[model samples]
Target: MLKPPYYPIIYVRGYAGTQEAVEDTVATPYMGFNLGSTKYRQTSAGKIEPYVFESPLIRLMKDHLYQDAFHDGQILPQGPVSPRSIWIFRYYDVVSKGLGNGERKEIEFHAEKLRQFILHVRSATGQDSNKDFRVYLVAHSMGGLVCRCYLQNKDIPDLEGKPPGDWKKKGVDKLFTYATPHGGIEFRKGFGWLEGLRDFLAINNADNFGKTRMREILSLEKNLPLHSLNNRFPAKRVFCLVGTNSQDYGISRKVVGPKSDGLVQIENAYVKESARAYTFRSHSGAYGIVNSESGYRNLERFLFGDIQVNVSLETLKIKMPGKEKNLSATYDIENNVSIRGLPIPVNKRTKDTFSSSFRSSDTLEEERTHLFTSFLLKTARLNKRRQSLGFSIHFRILPLYHQDKRFLPDRHYEGQAVFDDRLIIEVSKGGDSRFKVRYGWGSNNFKATKNLEFKVDKNNLSTAVIQLNQHRPVNMTAAIRFEVSAWN
Candidate 1:
């Protein structure tokens, strides 16, 4: 009887390499949405092993009971379809002259058409066309920009100054973009003739991609502004899945840099202050973020799960006994996580480097005010025995950051880490309808944990506790509240 968050999904694929590539994409039935991944996962034993992750389409069917709209290798069926159906915005067909009439339109045209397509989906799903109906938007690369253009401004130029329908009001419940350049990408990473040419193509003001359509659409040329994050949907509803594996990204990696996911820079992939998660995934490939298990796990949780876990340090108990100058400390917060029996890190962070670091001076709200991560937890994934999740948080303190640390007691202090009790999160059941989640954490410095339970009727969303001092007897008194939206 689980429902509400269950709605139709509209997927928008990334940019094509060539006009021929566009043609090839149009020829495909699912527009690459059916692509799967075969990769390795690092277990608690610290071993890399094999794991096969079917495409997002298959996972959705296996987990949430969703299905596609096609039948007999042809178009949609004649009768009304279920609300739990998936659809791809076949946008490239309009751009490919071979697929459509020899007419190619700008992104504005596509945005307007997308609004109309939602109406079509409502009618097809047996819902009232004019009434409100929710749908999740999952886009990749430039498709994310196209989604923004539609959601932000009036895509179609109004002849009589009439505003278009409010898409957010029309029911865009959640948005998830994979490797999208929300802040516009830069090709200023490398050198050489070919590298210069790549930058030239993307930065050129003429019909070339650098300075032409892509640049114009993304506001890459200087001070042009984009209203996508400010208008329509709220920032919290958008999830940016950032990719950080640049070496495997092929040609684009030449100009993008070692810190990018091939084409889009990690810094440019997310909206400011919005929810984002990072992984060692490329922009688009067999190991791409959109096709991998980590990516799928994040997408599923954000779209269909309930609960959010925001953690931070409200107070620091660490103090230097001696009056020592030229000293600094950095804490690398890492969480070892597994979600719903999925063979991937739920936050998509790595075992070694996937974490947020803080400086000794960064104690105010402007510097340290944010959640560690947020995830969707489903009741179906629970076993009869535990009915909860298992995880561990470790703090790796480092001493560096251009500070004058010439003298030190022990050099080993630069690489110190603290590991504590493994945590288990539990949810309430039975007649406790107001109850959503219940769990316990921490003890008297070196003691065991105490029970901490939360209720949904009170908007129980997120919780956290951290140990600040590296010395003996830790104080785990950090007040943390996370902003979480319940999906199912």
Candidate 2:
């Protein structure tokens, strides 16, 4: 039987510029969803290690008993298909020279077609009941924008001459994107000249990435930003997997610049208020974000996990030695979160990789810094003895002093961490149906050694806090706050 939150998933492939590229994309059965990696970075230093990651498509079938929506050499065949199936949007097929016309369509056209495809999948899966039909949209690059265009643009006219606004009724449970340029793609080399040239040519509708075109497609006002979902879609239901490795993205990185996944800047890769993760992966290639182990791990957890955990550093007070007022210091917090059995972290931001940045004193005055949010599958308990899910969080704080806008070399130490620690957390349900959280400092032991007090509100939300202490010259008092609740 199909399960809730394990409903069918629709994979949307990214941009295909030329007719040949569209044909190549259409020829693939799973559209790169079945691609896997044989190696991964073992450390933040870009150390390559041999590790086999069976692609997300195969893993879903083996781990969750999910099937693809293909039968008898045809997709969505005549018979009833499994509700727990995977479907490819195949939006570009219509524009592929081999499949349909050689002409191309705008992103709006692809999105409208996507809506039709979803409805067809719903019918083919025999999920007529509104409550039983739900699908997860997983896209890469431009495909993410297509999904957003469909979900967020309420005024988009359908083929039936009706405007689409009942997205919730269409049963889109959640959306996940890998290395999508949510804020539109921008090149760093040119002072807006290169972007203007690309947009003017409109090659393969490249103008879709331009801010003016983005506003039109997303139905946003001139005052609104390109990344804004316009409050049409729930920000919590979206997850953006950002890639941080720019060196591996080929010669394009020379123009795209650093601090990017190669093509999309890190700052432009995600929507505000949405959950996001950073990994040492590139935009496309062998080191691409879509085919990596970290990508699949985060994807499965966000799609099927029942428990949601939001971790943040709250109530911060930093004290520098022999200085109290007008302290010219920059602080950076590096964090990594990994599941119990995984060899790699699902979310990582380290100082060595240049993914973590220094926080200004003005921001610290607000006293809250979000670390990262992760989801845990309740049924996939790592600690069977305790019937709980387990994960560990590592934190490193680095501070650099400055005087008169000039670096003080004497006060800075290379590769120095002012404060560092790891917290191991195990969460399970108590007898009263409330959540029970157990945690311990990893420096103390490998397992949780203390119970974390949690207060369950009437809405079934539970929250806890852990204080981080022990620093030398810098007396910093910061508490890690966790808010846990049920997720689809």
Candidate 3:
């Protein structure tokens, strides 16, 4: 059998509140239940539900721009290439009746519908069952989750039952998702108010309504025993398109934190182990990510990128002590400040007078200085005059006073600094100590500069003497700080 030039693109819509809501607002008349002025309702659970609205894909192709393409007896526009077939599969939400049940049933219904749709396409195209044809799944929001459910569930018998062979190699090319919560959302943090309102309405049990159950089902730990990668199809075939612009609507306004595409947090949109993930100029709002131009372009790339790309974090290096440190290390780029791999306990105490600014005049500075000094003094006293504790400091220096034009208005000075312990020292009876210091310095315009300094002392475990002006120019504006830890 000759392979078709293009694969059919299937679009799936997100959660439509109810059958009535879908028919009335979400989808257009022809694509919705208003076709021929006759409302068609889906029947489930011994009740009649409004016809689930079709996705934008079908609306765009059939009822919108390319409507004539699929019209009966219509001739193709004369061109080098002829048009290929496109199909759409629409599924109803179990809660579309507003009765609130069947989250799992919804997934199963969509999966079965997709299978039937694929069979119908194959029969219509007259393709051999043994030959694999490209299948592109374009799902938005919970629709993506529903597709994942289909892919992860292997017990469903393949309707065609093609001979056991490399179907993937034949052409089962790709799966794409838009603004789908692959990682599951932190609904409480992002949509807390909506959740509260849903609870108030006593409609909290709705399936695919929030991130809670989706999270529970999609988690590696939870799904491992039931449908793990080892037991199910590899997830590397799936591609994710995430949204980063959150200004789409009121729903997008509720999500918390630094980055989001409005409805779904950027973090939740990308699946770590998926084949590929891309971010687009869309929000998590109902019509934003699904209908935007950027969304379509990214969807094309994800479906067609030569090689799939998976994102992950790499460990750079372990920062160690023994260098000429800076005084104002706050601006230093070398300052190894990561909450993930650090051992120091952060001071969480809130002092009424203390603020985050490190300026010498800030009320919090005095309290911080006092706290550090008192902590050191108590440690010295407890050691019985022995070198029981030690610290290494780092900082930066800038010519703030000499170069008025170069100084930053918002920043305290024009330099950066950082410090770490280079040597390990044990408490001695005489309270003497030896430690190495590493320092980094950088001007507002220049890249950072670094150097190492050594300090040796007797009976003074609290402070270290750094050799300055030895390795490079010491344009005084540099400040230094240190931390002391026992040898591990």
User: Which candidate tops lDDT?
Assistant: 2
lDDT of each model, Cα atoms only? 0.61, 0.83, 0.40
Q: Can you tell me which runs of candidate 1 are displaced by over 4 Å?
A: 1-3, 40-49, 72-79, 101-104, 156-167, 188-228, 313-323, 348-366, 369-371, 384-397, 401-413, 418-424, 427-449, 453-485
lDDT of 3 by residue, 1-488 (tens): 32332455555656555457544332332222111111244454666654433434443344323322234522211222212444445465333343334342545566656666666555555554545565666777777776666555443335455431343532335567777766554453555676556545634234354444543433335444321333234455566665555555454346533355555665577554553333333443443655554344344434432211111111111121224333222211111111111122111111111111132212212221211110122221344544333222222211221122345543434432222122222222233333433333323222222333433245323343223222233322122333332210
> Residues 1-488, candidate 1, lDDT per residue (tens digit)?
21468788999887776767778898897887889987777777999887788899888988888978776665444336778988888887877777686355666677667776666777778766434577888999878877776666444422122464554455567889999877665675344455446656642121223334554554343444332355455777788888878877778787777667887776678876567777778888877888877788788778876655544444433333245565444554444444546655555333343333444535532355343455646554556466444332332233232235457444325332432433444443336433344334434342224444443435554333433333533222334342333444
- Which RMSD values do the candidates have, in order? 5.1, 3.1, 21.7
lDDT of 3 at 199: 41
- Shift of residue 449 alpha carbon in model 2, Å: 2.2
Q: Could you tell me the lDDT of residue 301 within candidate 3?
A: 38
Candidate 2 similarity to native, TM-score: 0.92
Better of 1 and 2 by TM-score: 2
TM-score of each: 0.79, 0.92, 0.49
TM-score of 3: 0.49
